[model samples]
Structure formats: C-alpha cells, structure tokens
Target chain A: MKFLTPAQVTALMQDAVDAQGVDLGQIRAQLVLSPSERVDWLIAAVENLRAFRQKL
Target chain B: MTFDPRVICRILAEEGTEFVVIGGFAAAVRGSTVLTFDIDVVPDRERSNLEKLARALRRLNAQLRTGSEVLPLSINADFLDQMQVSLTLTTDFGDLDLVFQPAGPKASYADWADGADHVDLGNRLIVAIAALDDIIASKRAANRVKDQAALPALEALSEQIKSQT
Candidate 1:
C-alpha cells in the first residue's frame, strides 16, 4: 500500500473541499424546484448512488 | 436500500408524531442544492408525543446506528426522556436522526416548531420544516467539515428566499 506524505494528504483534502464548495448556479436551479420537487430530487440522487454502488 | 424520506415523513405524520424536520434535508427543502441521504428530525419531548414517535420508529424497523455496528433499539417515552443528545438510526426506509437539542439558536424542538414552515409533500402529507435561518444556525454551530461546506449555499438561498418575500 502506498501512503501519501502529510503535504500530499493536505493537498488532496484541499482539492476535495474545493470540489464540494457552493455553486450559485446550482443553488438557483434548485430554487426553481418546489419543496416536493426537492424531496424527489434527493430521493432520485440517493437511488442513483445506490445503483452505482451495487455495480462495484 | 435506497433512501426514501417522503415515506419516512408520511409514517411520522400518520402516527401523529410531533416533530420538525431539520439538518440537511431541511436545507434542501428550503432551496439548498446539497444532497443528503438521511432525514433528521427533532421530536417533541412530551410523553404522549414520544409514544407516538415510538410507534413510528417501530413501523420503520429502526435500529441504532453507531458507526459499523447496528444495534436493536427499544424505544418508548422513558427511553426518549433519557436521551440528552442526538440518536442516529437506520430504518427500512432510510436513515433518521432524532436530535433532542441541536446546537444552534433556540436549540429545542419546540423552538424549531414555533418557526417551522408547513410544507405540503403531496398526497396530503404536510410536514413542518425548520426555517432556513434556524437550519443555517444549527449548521454553523455544528462546525463540522461537511456542515461548513454546506453553509455558503444555504446562506445564499436564505438571502434569495428573503428577497422574494
């Protein structure tokens, strides 16, 4: 197993954080959805993830 | 199993459990684009309400989730009264967290209820969602890496929601 150095780990963590940061465009798109729609969106996303995991 | 929060909310409502939806699901309901797989709620501490919640939990086949170990949970009003912190459980429908005292402004279930917005989830299932301000406050107080990451979008949504009102 290869172990990342401290600096390498920090850089990877920072990249993950950057990738997860907020996007105003996405927020606006989501705002167009009613509360019920939002719930459906979440459920769909979760189902997609579950399917993806089963393939692994 | 896939996460289905609507079914979870419906069960709670059907059992007449008094609870306010909180955490990431609440944020999503209020227009944040964050994707959360679990539903978090703050149930009323009143004995009768706790009994109702217990029935809902049983119907969900809920088990206490502690890291990798899933333990059987025997829930009742007394068990709920002794819980001073959050309880995370995995149900047949999805994950549910019962938060007794969230770390934010007016941190009680009653407080969240006082300012909650009634949202219709269709089919006559209306649930109370914690206000955007309260959700933001709780996330800020939690200060976890994921919570911190979600704050910006939630704050922007809050501003947008306020502007339209």
Candidate 2:
C-alpha cells in the first residue's frame, strides 16, 4: 500500500473538493475516514467505478 | 495484594473463568514492551458476561461508571473472543483495569488463543499471548488514544524484524 504523507492526503482532499463539478460536502465525508482507509475508499468509489464504465 | 497481575488470571483460571492474559501484560511477557500492570484478560465468554464480571466486582467493591450510571467494580471486554479481565478489582488499595476484545480484528482473545504464544506464569501455568505485530498494529489502528501507546512498541518491533533479516 502506498503511504501518503499528511500533506499529500490533505492535497488530495482539497483537489477533490475544488473540482468545479463535484460537491465538497461529499468529498469531505470520504476524507473523514482514517487516512489508511481513504485509498481503499477512493479506489472502490472512484477508480473502480471509472473502470467499470470504461470496460463497458 | 500480589504485585503480579497474573495473580488474577491464575485465580480466574482456577475458578474456571475462560480467560487469557492480553494487552500490555501479554506484551511485557513476550519482551516486546517493558510495561507492567494488573492483568488484562480476554475471557472466553458470550453476551451478558458482564453479570459474572459484576459478581467479581462485588467482591472488590469496584467502581463502575458508564454514561450516567455508576456501578462499582467495573470491567471492559470490548469483544467476547478477545476480552480483557482485570484481576485487580477497583478499591482504595489500587485498581486493575481489565479490557476485553471480541473475535476478529486481531484484537480478539480467540485470535490470541489461536496464534498467541504460550509463556510460563510459574506454577506450571501458561497463558495465551497476542502477536507482537498484532499488538502494535491494533493499537496503532486506534490512532489518537492508542496510536501514541503503539509507537514505541512498533518502532522496537520494526527494529527486531529488520535485525532478523
């Protein structure tokens, strides 16, 4: 597993919220999960979803 | 009155309480940590085991406080399979806190029972112990409250693992 420094985690959260099209509230909630859990959460929530549709 | 916390586990073992010594006490025995205190035992138990713990508390007049309710002689067993029982009861003399953990998550007594090493507690008795990695990982997993406690041990274990290479 990739270990994200505190700063990196913070940046990722900021970018997710700053995205003009998405809701900041939901992005922040995913970050509420512990730092260790966020990667898995994002992988399952975003990456996998993106992949699922790309494959189709 | 015994300085050794295992005294309580030994007593419980004799009393037919299905329990195992865990937490820092277990770590100390395994030489992972220098910490010592009253015994923390995870009992082989089911739901409502607190009633039995209450009876033991009555003997020591332990002070139990949860939310607004206060019951003397309290204990913490977060999990049935990995419960922690304090052989030391709360009283003026001093108190021993027994914390419990249920099965799974490497915090369970069942996990310890299966994977925990056996150490002699004298009198030809042996008790189950949690894995050093499991101990460090679980404590760290708790982050804030336990993360600090886990740091030194984790560092030590990391050194030991590296040295073994």
Candidate 3:
C-alpha cells in the first residue's frame, strides 16, 4: 500500500477542520477518549481517506 | 528531567553528526500523534561520523540507562568504534537510542539518507527524519504489541496524506 506524503497529511489535517468540522489535532489532545472511542476515530479517519482519495 | 526533542535535534545538527531521526519521532514529525519516550536515531556507521556523534552525546552527558548496575562511564569515539550495532543511553535530555541498522528495507543510515525527509528548524539548523512510509514498514516488521497498536493511526494518517498529493 502506498503511504501518504507530508503535504498530503498536512492537507488532510486541514481538510478535517474545514470540510468535516472535526479537528483531529484537538481530538488527539483529549485525554479521556476511551479505547473504543479512539478506535472509532481511526475507522472514521480511514473512511475519510477513502473518500478523499476518490476525489483525486 | 524531561528533555525537549527539538533541543536534541539541534544539538546533533550543530555538532555536524550524520544521522536521521527514526521510529516514533519520525512518525510524529510526519503527523502521527504517537507519543514516544525517546529519540531514536540511525547514525552513520563511519568512524568519523561516529566520532562526531560521540562528541554530541558527551555534550549531552549521555550514560547507559538500564536496570542493572549503573555504570558511571561515558561514550567516546574510541569506545564507539569498538561497540556493537545498537546502544541505548540516557542523557540529560532523556533517552537517546543509537541504532546502527534500523529494522526495515533501508538497513543503514546511508540507505535511508536519500529517502529521508529534511526538517528545517530555522537558524540554519536542519535535521533528517526517516520517511513515514519507511517507519510504518519498520513498525510492521517489528510486530510488537505496542508497534501493532500504532499501525491504525499511522495507516489512517497515511491515507489522509495520500489524498493530498
């Protein structure tokens, strides 16, 4: 599987805030995320990537 | 004493040490929010480069960190030249792992140099970091439970990155 470039990661982080109204940086900073909640975030991130990739 | 990694990077760069930051630090540099305790680096294996690294470590007051009897000894050029492939030391700045060969497609510092990412820290301080993809590959190869735990975040981050360019 191809890995993401630096620019792509930065763009995705920015897009998360702009398009999805989610700030992953803030989510990561939250200390109370349960194990399952973190898993959910990962799943959502993957789906986001899939959607973003299709747009390219 | 908690050591800021930016200081560690600057110290190495200022000393003209030939090395690349790898492992968790590299992942973090590329936007993986993985928390890492130590700064892992693959320093060039050449005698001269190792000499430079020894000097930098000395300046940091590096000492072997282990549960066994703590040795008050120090790492110097002559000692490093005769040492093994990897050494883990504790410094005033925290743990600094010197890896001679990282566990990945790129086995040595020279091998990864071309693919490494350069991070400019302003004021003419530049440091090399291993590529995120390679870090992922190495993590997968390591396959420890901790390493396994890091994959999802890194994978998802990779996807997000792939979407950008």
Best by DockQ: 1
Supply the global lDDT for candidate 3: 0.72
- lDDT tens readout by residue for model 3, A1-56: 99999999999976654444333564344324533343234335545665787899
Candidate 3 residue runs with Cα over 4 Å from true position: A1-56, B67-70, B122-124
lDDT of 1: 0.88
Task: List runs of model 2 lying over 4 Å from the truth.
Answer: A1-56, B47-94, B102-104, B161-165
Return the lDDT, model 2, position A53.
73
Please give the lDDT score at residue B5 for candidate 3: 64
lDDT of 2 by residue, B27-105 (tens): 5554433334344566555554554544444444456434465455334443222434323344332234555653237
Q: lDDT of each prediction vs. the true structure?
A: 0.88, 0.50, 0.72
**In candidate 3 chain B, where is summed lDDT lowest over 10 consecutive residues?**
B65-74
- Cα error, residue B86 of model 3, in Å, equals 1.5
Q: Write the per-residue lDDT of candidate 2 for residues A16-38, one digit (tens) a residue.
A: 54353333344345334432243
| Preferred candidate (DockQ higher): 1 or 2 | 1
**Number of the top TM-score candidate:** 1
Question: In lDDT terms, which candidate is top?
Answer: 1
Q: How close is every model to the real structure, measured as TM-score?
A: 0.88, 0.52, 0.72
- TM-score, ranked from best to worst: 1, 3, 2
lDDT of 3 by residue, B1-165 (tens): 554566777788878999988887667666665557678898888888888888898888888877674455567788887766678888886678888867767888888787897876445557787888888998898799888777767776676667657
